[model samples]
Target: MRSQLRPETRIDRCFEALKREGRPAFVTFVTAGDPDYETSKAILLGLPEAGADVIEIGMPFSDPMADGPAVQASSLRALKAGQTMKRTLQLVREFRAKDNLTPIVLMGYYNPIYVYPSEAFLDEARDAGIDGMIIVDVPPEADEELCLPAIQRGLSFIRLATPTTDDKRLPAVLANTSGFVYYVSITGITGAAAPVVSDVRAQVARIKRSTPLPVVVGFGVRTPEQARVIADCADGVVVGSALVETIRTTLGTDGRAGPDTVSAVHRIVHNLAAGLRGAAARV
Candidate 1:
């Protein structure tokens, strides 16, 4: 049964829809205003049609500690291109203009939101049609500061459950986590190494036992086959670094988005989505 403690959100609706289709959600992440605003906006607008079930827009910050090299570089590009918190919210608003069904979750550190003054940022984010948030730096113990407040404002405060999150520590992680539980498939930062499918299966099962929320595995996933294997065991698959790398590869010599940037990224997403759909068909 779905948890009744929190209100039904777009993120909830997305997973429910995927459940009905018997497939795992294909979640994609990209840095807002990477390269530039227009190019980033174009990529955001095309994701849903390209097979992305949920979109995570990285709120560009100077020091993104939790990210790997690819994601960290993407953030730097966005910041160098003048991406700000306001611009990030603007990207969401533009995406909302065309896509109301797809869930948009802002993923980043706490410093930006903290300097945005937190409360005002939440109000603006909600108004801009953001569905949830994955603030990597904030913990459950600091719920009073942001997590609880975000939940109060109808935004799902998603939490990350690492491989090291044992049974004793699981409850606290799930206590305030809504939307879904993001199971970090590996220990280190995003895009470290390929996770062993059997290990991922065990950890995802462990997380499921503790929470009613859907469990989505991420971090080491890079290819369509990997997405398929991971989705076979988890409720969803999140691929970030791979897609960001696609953007990097397709850029022009001067580092701006080339003609193939949008299409290349979409191509990867389409293939990943196909992989997840194939997993569903096998079931």
Candidate 2:
């Protein structure tokens, strides 16, 4: 079945450019307002220059069930620092002012969007320069609530295809999915274990047979070596827990962003991007 068409977003363009360069995209994830707004913004502004091809800014939520400890803690820190839906959008708006080409995807659960009142949230998100969204809680079954509306408004509604997403369930998952298909390399929560390269290669092939959208693998991907191997088989690689952990470790004793917090995260991103560059693109 042919997938529905949506507006050509920054995400599509980013992947097109990466394909021409013969390398997988280095997608980074950081919590919006993590530690604090200023620190988060500084980190956001530097990502493109540090070699991130696509950026996934996590929206701080009280209960991010899909995430592991590192991302959960990042959310708590952001929320403690007064991160809100509006502030998250403001972060994107501010990032857009400096860099316009890198695609930005807001990733998190749906409660915040629901509370921001759905339609209004989509409008503001687009205006704020968000290219797509990864709402873990909203399934393909409930596309009417948010997915359809978001696509209609020009936001790519990215979907996740897990290890368990068998052939039977794969089509529905890809139906409304746009921008790309995020293949969760592991079966469990984020950052739980290392992804088997062979397993990832097989799963990515399976997903590719179903759709033409770029398939990026994530979960349990931490080091540059791991990123390189994963990127070899997928269109892109997403590093969330690893990046969030970098921020956590760089925080001052007072649990705030120290001087090195921003630079440390950017450095890690640079190394990861270098890994992607070194990878042999999948045939």
Report the C-alpha lDDT of model 1 over 214-278, residue by residue, as the tens digit: 99999989999999999999999999999999999999999999999999999999999998899
lDDT of 2 by residue, 45-89 (tens): 999999999999999999999989999999999999999999999
Cα TM-score per model: 0.98, 0.97
**Residue 30 error for model 1, in Å?**
0.7
TM-score of 2: 0.97
What's model 1's lDDT at 135? 96
Best by TM-score: 1
Off by over 4 Å in 2: 1-5, 281-283
Candidate 1 achieves a global lDDT of 0.93
Off by over 4 Å in 1: none
